[model samples]
Target chain A: MHISYNQKEVLKGINLSVEKGEVVSFIGPSGTGKTTLLKCINYLEKPQQGEIQIGDLHLNYQSLSKQDILKLRRKTAMVFQMFNIFKHKTVIQNVMDAQIAVQKKSKNEAYAMSLKQLENVGLKDKINEYPSRLSGGQLQRVGIARGLALEPELILFDEPTSALDPELVEEVLKVIEDVAKSGMTTLLVTHEMDFAKRISDKVVFMENGHIVEVGTPEQIFEKSVNVRTRQFLKKIYAEQDQQKLNIKGG
Target chain B: MTLETGMQELLMEFLKTLPINIIIIILSAALGLLFAVLLTFVRLKRIPVISQLADLYVSFARSVPGLILLFIAYFGIPKVLPLIGLGTYDISPMHAAIISMGFYHSGYISEVFRPAYLAVEKSQHEAADSLGYTPMQKFFRIILPQMVPVALPGYGNALVYLIHDTSLIFAIGIVDIMGTAELSIARSYGTNQILIYFIIALMFSAMCFTTDGLVRKLEKRVAIR
Candidate 1:
C-alpha cells in the first residue's frame, strides 16, 4: 500500500502485498523512512495518502481516531528499536500489566500467558527480575515476549537488532528467525542482510522513501534489475564479504 | 499535690481549645494538599508564568524558615484581607500558622516529583498508546503507578515537616502538647530550665524516631525497577 507523511510523499504511490505466512524484510539506509513506513502500517502514525489493511481490519486516515486505532493496535504489534519494557516492573510483570489491565485477563490467566511468552523467548528464569537486571540481548527477548503475549496477527519489527551489541545481535536475530519460520506474517526493518536472505520470503529494497527493488530472496539478492539496488547492496555487503574471502584464501 | 494541680490545669486548658486546634490543622492540611496538587499540575502542563510563581513561593518559604512564614501570614493577612473584606474575618495566629506550614513545604514536594516524571522512558508511553490505552488508562495504570515509588520519598519528608511544624501552631494560641507543656511549666515550676528542656526533647524524640523508621521501611519496599 502507498503511504505518505505531511503531504510530501514518503511511500510514493508504492504497491505490495504479503500472503499469509510470508516474511518480508525492508532494508535501507537510515532516514529513508523505514521506521515511518512501519509506524504507518501499524496505524501508530496515520498515513495521509493510503490504505492500511491488517488481517480483516481496514484503516485509512479516518480510522486513525483514538478508539479505532487502539482497536487496530490490539490486532497488530510493533517491537520498537529500543526495548520499551516498563522500567518500574519485573520482566514478567511488564508482560502481564497490559494483559490484566486492558485485556482484563485474570491474574492467573495473565501469569500463565506471561510465563508461556517468557519461556518462548528463553527468559523464563528472569521472570521476577527487573529490566535493569537484564543484558541488551535479554531485554530485547523480553520485549519480543511482550509483543508475543498479545498473540497479534501480524508483528512489525523496526530494526530489532540494530540497538544490540555485536555479540548480542545473534540471539535477538535467532528469536526473530524462529518467529519468521513459525509462519506468522512478519515485516522487519533490519540491517542484518544475511538474516534477511536466510529467512525472508520476500525482500523489499527501499531507497529515498520508495521501493527500488521488491522480489523473493533469490530474485532480489542474486538477480537484480535495478542498478541502484546493486550499488546499495555492494556498499552494504562489501566489507563482510571481503573478510570472508580473505579467511578462505588463508 | 502541687504538680498534680499543674497537670490538671494543662489538660483543662488543652481540652477547652482542642476543637479549634484540630480543625485548623485538618482544614489547613487539606488546603495545602490542594495547592500542592495544583502547583504540580501547573508545572507538568508547562505553564511558564505559574511554574515561576510556584518556584518563587517555594524558595521564599524554605529560605525564611517556617516560624517566620507563620509570623508573616498571621500578621500580614489581616492587613491585606481588609481590602478584600476578608478584613471582617478574624484571622487567628493558628490559622495563619497552619497555612504557612502546609504551603511552604509543598514546594519541596513538587520539586522531588519533577525529575521522576522525566525519568519515565518515553517508549513506555508509546507502547501504552500503541496498545490503545485511553488517556485515563495511560495515566492511572501506566504513569501514576510508576510515579508512586518516586513520590513516596518526597511525601515522607513532607509528613515529617507537617508534624514538626505543628509546634508553630502553639504560637497562634492552639493549646497543643507544646502549648500545654509551656503553660503547665510556667505555673508549676516557675523557672526550672533543665526540666523543661528534658521534657520537651524526650516527647519530640518518640514521634521523630517512629516517623523516621516508617520512612526508611517504605523506601526499601518501593525500590524502583
Candidate 2:
C-alpha cells in the first residue's frame, strides 16, 4: 500500500495481513503511519495504490466502485481514537443505528442486538444516557459496543485509548481484552505497549511509513534482531520504567 | 385628527394588519430555509458548474439591496419574461415581497447552515462510514441532527431580520402593518404621524422580544449535554 497527502508519502509500499480470529497490533511513534494503515484497510484513507483483501473480498483502490466499497465496509467495523459515538443518540441508539439503517433489521431486532452488545461491554446501565453524559472510558465502550452490534467479520481499533484520561484507560482495555478472548479478528493501533504485548498474536513495528519488523510478541519484545526495532522498544521500555518509578514515589 | 382618535386608529390598523405581517414573515422564512438547504448542499457537493452558480447566486443576493431585488422581481421580471416568450408576468406585491425576501434571506441562511454543518467533526463521518451507512442515511441520521443546535441561533436571527424586512413590502403597495400605518397617517393629514410611527415601533419590539425568548427556550432544550 502507498498513501500520500499533498505529494508527501505517508504509507510507503507496506504489506501485512491478519489471520482469521487473530489479533494483530501495529505499534509505532506518531506520524509513522500506524493509524493510516488501519484506515486504509477499510479504505477510509483511500491509499493511492495497492489492493486489500478482507477474507473473500478484494478491493483495488483504483478500480473499486462505490458499491464495492460499501460491500467491503459492511464486513468490517472500526472503533475510532476519539470514540465517535453519535452525540445526538443515547448509548443504545448509537449501537442500534447501523443495524436498523444498514442491516435493514426491524426495530425490535436492532433493539435486542443493541441491548446484547451493550451488555457485553458492561454498559447495561448506560443505555439511556447520551455520549456527553458518559465518561471517556464509557464512551469508548459504547463505541466498541456499536462496532460489535454490526457482527462484522473484522474490527479495527485506531488508538482507542489514546484520548482517555489515564485513570479511565483500564476499563476500555479490559473490554478490548474480552473482545480479543472471544476470538474476533482485530487490528489495533496502540500506544499501550503492555496491553499490545499481552494480547496481540503478532506484533508489527513501523517507522517512517515502512514496516520495520514483524514477529511474535516474544520475538518483538524480548528477542528482536532488527536494530531499529530494538531502539524503539528500548525507548518505550525506559519511558514505562520511569512512569512506574514516578507512580511509586508520588 | 385629535390624539385620542389617532391612537385608536393606529391600534385598529395594527390589529387589522397583524395577520398579513405574520403571513409574510412565515412564508418568506420557510421558503428561504428551503432555498438555503439547496444552496448549502450544492456548495458542499462541489458540483462543477452548478456549485459555482450557487456561489454566484449567494454572493449577488447578499450584496444587492433587498429593495432593489424586490423591484427587479416586481417590475423588471415582467418586462424580461415577455421577451423570453414566457408571456408577461404580473405578480402581486405580496408575491413580490415573498419571492424577493425568500431569495434574499437564503444567502444569509446558507452562510449559517454551511459552517454549522462543517463544525461537526470529521470523526462523525468516518464512524458512520465504517458502520456502512449510505450517504443519504449518514446525512439524515448523523449530520443533520447535530447541525440543528448549532444552526438555531443563526436561524432565529434570520427570522427576526425577515420580520423587520416585511416593512419593505409597503414600498410595493402591500397593506401590511407598516403600509397600514403609513396609510392611516396620510388619511389623518400627517397630524398623527408621530403617534402612528411610535406604535409601529413598539409592535415590532414586542415581536422581536417574543422571538428572542422562544429561541432561548429552544436552545436550552436541545443543548448537547
Candidate 3:
C-alpha cells in the first residue's frame, strides 16, 4: 500500500500479507504510519494507491467506491487507543450498537451476543455502566467487546493500550492476548515490545514510512540482521529497563 | 384604589394576554430550533453558497437588535411579498413576531448546535465507521444522543432569550403581556403604573425560571449517558 497525505508519502509502497488467524504486530516510533496502515486496511484512511484484499473483498484504492469501502470495513473492526466506545451508551449498548446497526440483529439477538462478548472481556459485572464510570482497562475491554460482538473476520488494534495508565495496561493486554490466542486474525500497532514479542505470530518493524524488517519475535528482538531494527530494539529495551528501574526506585 | 385591588386588577389583565405570549414563545422556539438545525447542518457540511448565506443570516441575526428584526418582519415582509409578485399578503403582528423571534434566535441556537455537534469527538465517527454503521445510523444512534446533552445548556439559554425577546413584540402593537400592561396603564392615566410593570416583570421571570428548570431536568435525563 502507498499512502500520502498532502503530497507527502506516509506509507511508501508497503507490501505485506497475513495468513488467516495469524496475529501480526506492527511496531515503530511515532509518525511511521503504523496506525495509518491499520486505518487504511479498514478504509478509515484512504490510501493514494494500493490494493487491499481481506477475505473475498478486494479493493484498489484508486477505483474504490463508497460502497466498496463500507463493504471492506464491514469485514473488520478496529480497537482504538482511546477506546472510542460510545460514551452516551452503556457498556452493553456499546457492544450491541454495531451488532444492531451493521449486522441488523434484533434487540434480543444483539443483547445475547453482546452479553456473551462482554463476558468474554470480563465486563459482565459492568454491563450497565457507562464508559465514563469504568476505569481505562474496563473501557478498553468494552472497546474489545464492541469489536468482538461484530464477529469480524479480522480485528485491528491501533495501539489499544497506548492511552492507559501503566497499572491498567496489563488488563487490556491480557484481553488482547486472549483474543489473539483464540485464533482471530489480528493486526496490532503497539509500543508494548514484550507483549508484541510474546503474542504476535509475526512482528513487523517499521520506520520512516517503510518496513525496516519483518521477522518472528526471536529473530527481530534477539538477532535482527537490519541495523535499523536492532537499533530501535536496543533503544526501546533500554527505555523499558529505565522505566522498570524507576518503578523499583519509586 | 388599594394596592391589593390594583394588583388583582393588573394581574387579571396580564393573565388574559398571557396565552398569546406563551403561544408566541412556543411557536417561535419551534421555528427557531428547526432553522437552527438547518443552519448548523449547512455550516457543518459547508454547503457552498447556501452555507455562506446561512453564515450571513447568522451574522445578521446575531448582530442586529431583536426589535429591528421585529420591525423588518412586520413592515418589510408584507411589502417585499407584493414586490416579488406573491400578491398582497397581510402579515399580522403575531405572525411577524413569531417570524422575527424565530429567525433572530436561530442564530444563537446554531452557534450552540454547531459547537455541540463538533464537540462529539472525531474518534466516535471513526469507531462507528469501523463498525460499518451507515451514516444515518451513526448520527441517530451515536451522534445525536451525545450531541443533544452537550447542546442543552446553550439551547436552554436560547429558549430563555427567546422568552425575553418576545417582549419586543409589544413594540409592533401585539396585545401580549407587555402590550396589555401598557394598554392598562394608558387607560388608567398612569394609575398603578409601577405595580403593573412590576407584575409583568414577575411573569417574564417566572416563565424564564420554568424554562430553565425544564431544560435542567431534560439535561439530567439525557446526560444519563
Candidate 4:
C-alpha cells in the first residue's frame, strides 16, 4: 500500500497481512503512519495505491467504488483513539447505531445485542448515560463494545489507550486483552510495549512509514537483529524505568 | 384621547393585521430554512460553478436591505415568471414579500448552519464512516442531530431579525401590521401617531421575545447530554 497526502508520502509501499484469529500489534513512535495504516484497512484515509484482501473480499484502491468502500468497512471495525462515540446518543444507542445502520438489525434485536456487548464491557449499569457523563476509560470501553458487537472479521484499534489518562489505560487494555484471548483477529496500533508484549501473537515495529521488523513478541522485545528496533525498545524501557522510579519516590 | 385609551384602540387595529404578518413570517421562515439547507450543502460540497453562485447569492442576500429585496421581488418575479412559462399567474405583494424575506433569511441562516456543522468533530464523521453508514444516514442521523443544538441560538436571532424585516413589506403595499399601522395613521391624518407607533413597537417586541424564548427552551431540550 502507498498513501500520499497532498503529494507527500505517508505510507510508502507497505505490505502486510493478518491471518484469521491472529492478534497482530503494530508498535511505533508517533507520526510513523501507524494510525494511517489502520485507517487504510477500512478506507477511512484513502491510500493512493494499494490492494487489500480480508478473507475472500479483495479490493484495489485505485479503482475502488462507493459500494466497495462500504463492503470494506463492513468487514472490519475500528476503535478510535478519541473514542468518537456519538455524543448525541445514549451509551446503548451508541453501540446500537452501527448494528441498525449497517447490520440492518431491528431496534429490538439491536437493543439486545448492544446490551450483551455493554455487559461484557461492564457498562450495563451505564447504558442510559451519555458519552459526556462517562470517564475516558468507560468511553473507550463503550467504543470497544461497539466494535465487538459487530462481530467483524477483523477489528482495528488505533492506539486505543493513547488518549486515556495513565491510570485509566489499564481498564481498556484489560478489555482488549480479553478480545485477544477470545481468538478474534485484531490489528492494533499502540505504544504500550508491555500490553502489546503480553497480548500480541506477532509484534511489528514500524518507523517513518516502514516496517523495521516483524517477529514474535519475544523476538522483537528480547533478541532483535534490527538496530532501530533495539534502540526504540531501549528508549521505551528507559521511560518505563523512569516512571517506576518516580512512582516509588512519590 | 389619553395615552392608555389611544394605545388600547390602536392595539386592536394592529392585531387585525397580525395574522397576515404571522403568515409571512411562518411561510418565509420555512422557505428560508429549505434554501439554507440547500445552500449549506452546496457550500460544504463545493460544487464548482453552483457553489460560487450560491456564495454570491448569500453575500447579496446578507448585504442588501430587505426593503430593496421586497422591491426587486415585487417587480422582478412578474417578469421572470413569464419567461419561465408561468405567464398567466400574477404575483401579489404578499407573495413577493414572502419570497424576498425568504431569500433574505436564507443567507443569515446558512451562515448559522455552515459553522454549526463544522463545529462537530470530524472524528464523528469518521466514526460513522467506519461503521459503514451510507452518506444520507450519516448526515441525517449522526450529523444533523448534533448540528441542531449548536445552530439554535443563531437561528433564533435570525428569526428575530426576520420579524423586524417584515416591517419593510409595508413599503410594497402588503397590509401586514406595519402596513395597517401606516394606513390607520394616514386615515386619522397623523393624530396620535406616537401612540400608534408605540403600540407597533410593543407588538414586535413581544413577538421577538416569544420566538427567542421558544428557541432557548428547544435548545435545552435537544442539547446533547
Query: What TM value does model 2 have?
Result: 0.94
True contacts kept of 1: 0.49
**Of 3 and 4, which scores higher on lDDT?**
4
Q: Return the lDDT, model 1, position B57.
A: 72
How well docked is model 3, in DockQ terms?
0.75
Q: lDDT per residue, candidate 4, B1-225, as tens digits? A: 887796677778678889999999999999999999999999989999999999999999999999899999999888888898987567899899899999999999999999999999999999999989999999999999999999999999999999999988889888888888888889889996887788789889999999989999999999998
* Tens-place lDDT digits, model 2, residues A106-167: 99999999999999999999899988889999999999999999999999999999999999
Candidates' TM-scores? 0.80, 0.94, 0.95, 0.95
Candidate 4 achieves a global lDDT of: 0.91
* Candidate 3 local lDDT, B1-225, one digit each (tens): 897897787788788899999999999999999989989999999988999999998998999999999999999999999898999999999999999999998999999999999999999999999999888888999999989999999899989989999988999999899999888889989976897788888999999999999999999999844
- DockQ scores for all the models shown? 0.46, 0.84, 0.75, 0.86
Q: Identify the leading candidate in terms of lDDT.
A: 4
In model 4, which runs have C-alpha deviations exceeding 4 angstroms? A1-8, B1-9, B81-90
lDDT of each: 0.77, 0.89, 0.90, 0.91
Please give the lDDT score at residue B192 for candidate 1. 52
TM accuracy, model 3: 0.95
Residue B70 accuracy (lDDT) in model 4: 91
For model 4, name the residue pairs that clash. none
lDDT of 3 by residue, A72-168 (tens): 8888989999899898889998998888888889999999999999899898999998788999889999999899888889999999998999899
lDDT tens digits by residue: candidate 1, B1-225: 597885576556656655554555466557776777777777778787887887777676567777778878888788888787764566876667767877776676666666667667678888787665666787777787777777777777776666667767777676776776687678766575456556656655666577678878987887775
lDDT of 4 by residue, A1-250 (tens): 2222321388776878678899999998889988988898898888888788888887888889999999989888999999999999999999998899889999999999999999999999999999999999999999999998988988899999999999999989999999999989999999999999999999999899887898999999999989999999999999999999999999
Task: Report how far residue B152 has shifted in candidate 2, in Å.
Answer: 0.6
